[model samples]
Target: MKVSAEIAGFMKRLGHEFAQPELLVRALTHSSVVSPTRPDNQRLEFLGDRVLGLVMAEALFAADAKASEGQLAPRFNALVRGETCAAVARQIDLGQVLKLGRSEMMSGGRRKEAVLADAMEAVLAAVYLDAGYAKAQAVVLKLWGARLDGVAEDARDAKTALQEWAQANGMPPPVYDETDRSGPDHAPIFHVTVRLADGRSAEARGQGARRSIEQAAAQSLLAQLEALA
Candidate 1:
């Protein structure tokens, strides 16, 4: 199937020209728009997740010469998580090209984190099918870019790291409290504060879930402590 000018432009941003353009079209087709003749991207998303995992694993292994499995695993998770994938999708404007049903489009489906993440993976799968593993790996690396260099810092579980820091410094565990919450029930934004036994504290706000907000708060606190040190 022939792709439109917009999709061709997306391909250029994605850094791979598809020999079978239909794969890319299918990759961008959401389940909300699926029909008997029009396949969706769920299957492609599944395959792409594995492909992404493999590429990340190999890259991390090569990047760090002395890191243990425990060290590498969390970095892998950070790199392959939905948040990171969605971030990559946004970088390439993948959401703008997503084909959604009217209902989904009305609901702002293109901007939904899960939808963008899934479509990013599906697009990877399409590239893999159109060419080969090497080509797909190249695309992933190119898109991921500087993220690979910073994965070590990004991989740390901020809450856990903060707690560990408190312990190492002979302070009690840091405390996290929700300062405020707002927005609709379906999408609440949480404001959280993390305070140490020594009275040092930091605050941060985030959307999606409470745990993520806590993590953000902890990360903020960590940054503050690092600056003081």
Candidate 2:
């Protein structure tokens, strides 16, 4: 385990004191660290994923008392998904906290979306375990509320684009599938399948719901149109 005053500052911004800073550090430590007792983030990644989701779900439910679980569930999944977390992690310089061997560091571990997403999840887990749900919720809200809202706005644009593309080509609008998801609550991976009217399929991933499905749809449409040409 490693600790530094510098890393403490990073945690400070996230608004929690680690009950086990080692876990927090391990969450940031890549597989490439020193050999003797090096620990990677995979295990913490597992815990963080669940913690992240619960917090997001709680936030959604509390914010909108009138929204039924059926209505709120998908939105909850979207906000805490992996791609969104990775994007949020990027925004907060989470990569800088990561500990990698010189080789991994130079090769751009900092820029790998999956790694960043995992670290974010681990940190969120640590937050939940350390400070409990309420404080963890606050940290996440400050970090992600505007971003989730933006994701919703992007959803509207995606469907509009799909519609326009369909009408222009005289083709039927696409269909979307919720294939799979991974990661903890704060960050998950949503796999979407988009099918054309003719039964062709295209798959895509997004940090959140509507965009992920739209990506699937857009990819399918593009592939179908390309084949026709």
Best by TM-score: 1
lDDT of 1: 0.91
Candidate 1 stretches greater than 4 Å from native: 163-179, 183-188, 194-201, 206-212, 224-229
Kindly list the per-residue Cα lDDT of model 1 for residues 144-177, writing each as its tens digit: 9689887874477899899989999999999988
Candidate 2 regions exceeding 4 Å error are 34-36, 148-229
Kindly list the per-residue Cα lDDT of model 2 for residues 147-202, writing each as its tens digit: 65554422333445666676686778777777887864434568787765667667
Q: Candidate 1, 56: how far from true, in Å?
A: 0.9
- Please state the error at residue 105 of candidate 1 in Å: 1.8
**What TM-score goes with each of the models?**
0.84, 0.65
Residue pairs whose backbone atoms clash in candidate 2: 49-184, 49-185, 50-184, 52-185, 52-186, 53-185, 53-186, 81-188, 82-188, 84-207
The TM-score measured for candidate 1 stands at 0.84
The candidate that wins on lDDT is 1
- Give the RMSD in angstroms, all C-alphas superposed, for model 2: 8.7
Residue 192, model 1: lDDT of 92
